[model samples]
Target: MASTSSNKSRCATCGKNIGTFTCRGCSQDFCLSHAQEHRQLLGKQMDEDVILMHDQFQQCLNEQVKQPSLHPLMKEINEWEKQSIEKIQLVAQVARQKVLNIISKHTDNVIIALTSIKEQLSRARDDDDFFESDINEWKENLEKLKTDLNTPKAITIKFDDKMNSFIPKISVHKERPITERFERFLGDIQIEENGQLITHGNSNAHATVRGKGEYSSGQRLFRFKIENKRTS
Candidate 1:
């Protein structure tokens, strides 16, 4: 017991006869008073490290809020969308106008024919012997009615939707009126948080995104990649 006590280190700061504690970090032996001082100094260093990390986190969050409203890729996407919608609108308008014109032509012809038939039927109902004298004429009028009923239905409006050829394809089809036949959409669209996208319209498409922090300026840099997509 005497040998073990004598071999132990003495206080580093206080030059005491014996030391009760040894610092784990620096391997320095100290009396009670000096040991407490060392612990407080280590704690201060740890607190400084924590505060530095906290400040970095807060700065990153603030930069997100201050980010620009439009990125280069975003602008490109907006232009693409605008052009696509305009094309769709033009096609729809042409189809609508054509269908209306056909309907108008048929309506006018049908009304004139029906009005003539109504006059003949009214005269026959007033005079019971009218058909008896002009049975052949009545038969001719009935044959004309049959001809009108058998008019050829040649014109029709059809919807054909297509999607971009890039990484994700967006295919749109003409949906029939909401009747019993619920025509399903032909394509799908999927987007990820990191700017990756996948879609299928007429075919498959994909996109990728990359981002980095500009350390010197505290700004963000972004890049986008697209594949197999046609803008319009």
Candidate 2:
């Protein structure tokens, strides 16, 4: 009977004797001696698989702490900063050229007027036939010309206070309403009123506009009001 019972069940590892203990997790039967060996093997596997993975994750965490700028999001922010600076430089270059051109033209006009006054004074001085009334009139004209030369009425510098900055602002939000403004547009579209208002610029053609924000998922809502319409 003992021989028959021992032969009926065999150890999973040794496969020669009856299996006394069965692992509830693996469902494999083992003899008393091999059961302890199987538990030891499981312990070794836990160290190799679980604890080793944890150590590897810890190393990644340490690297993140040392160099936060290595993140992908940081790279995107850096790119945005670089592009914003380039835009500012481009606008400044155009503005500088415009102001310089205006100043040159204004100076040429002033010099032309001054030359006319100079010729009159020179002719009168040589002739020596000018009266006090003529002298007072010439003096008054000279003073007016001097004032015009110092301060040209045509040159005016203005800043748009509604535009807080030439570069648009960015922020992070959790389900909060995001502000979207028109960025790039084609055809005859005009962005006005601090970027909140959009108006059609031309009556002849159609206009298309692209917004600043992009969304992959989530419900979004947009609102617009038609303030006025062009007649004809």
The best candidate by lDDT is: 2
Measured against the true structure, the TM-scores of the candidates, in listed sequence, are 0.32, 0.42
Q: Pick the candidate with the highest TM-score.
A: 2
lDDT of 1 by residue, 74-146 (tens): 7799899999888767766777776566656666766787788778778877886465546677677667656
In model 2, the Cα lDDT at residue 10 comes to: 75
Task: In angstroms, give how far residue 138 of model 2 lies from its true place.
Answer: 4.2
lDDT of 2 by residue, 4-107 (tens): 55345677899857646778889887887888899999999999999999999999889889999877789999999999888767767776776677667777
Q: Please estimate how well model 2 matches the true structure, expressed as its whole-model Cα lDDT.
A: 0.76
lDDT (Cα, 0-100) at 232 in candidate 2: 70
Off by over 4 Å in 2: 1-60, 67-76, 131-147, 161-232
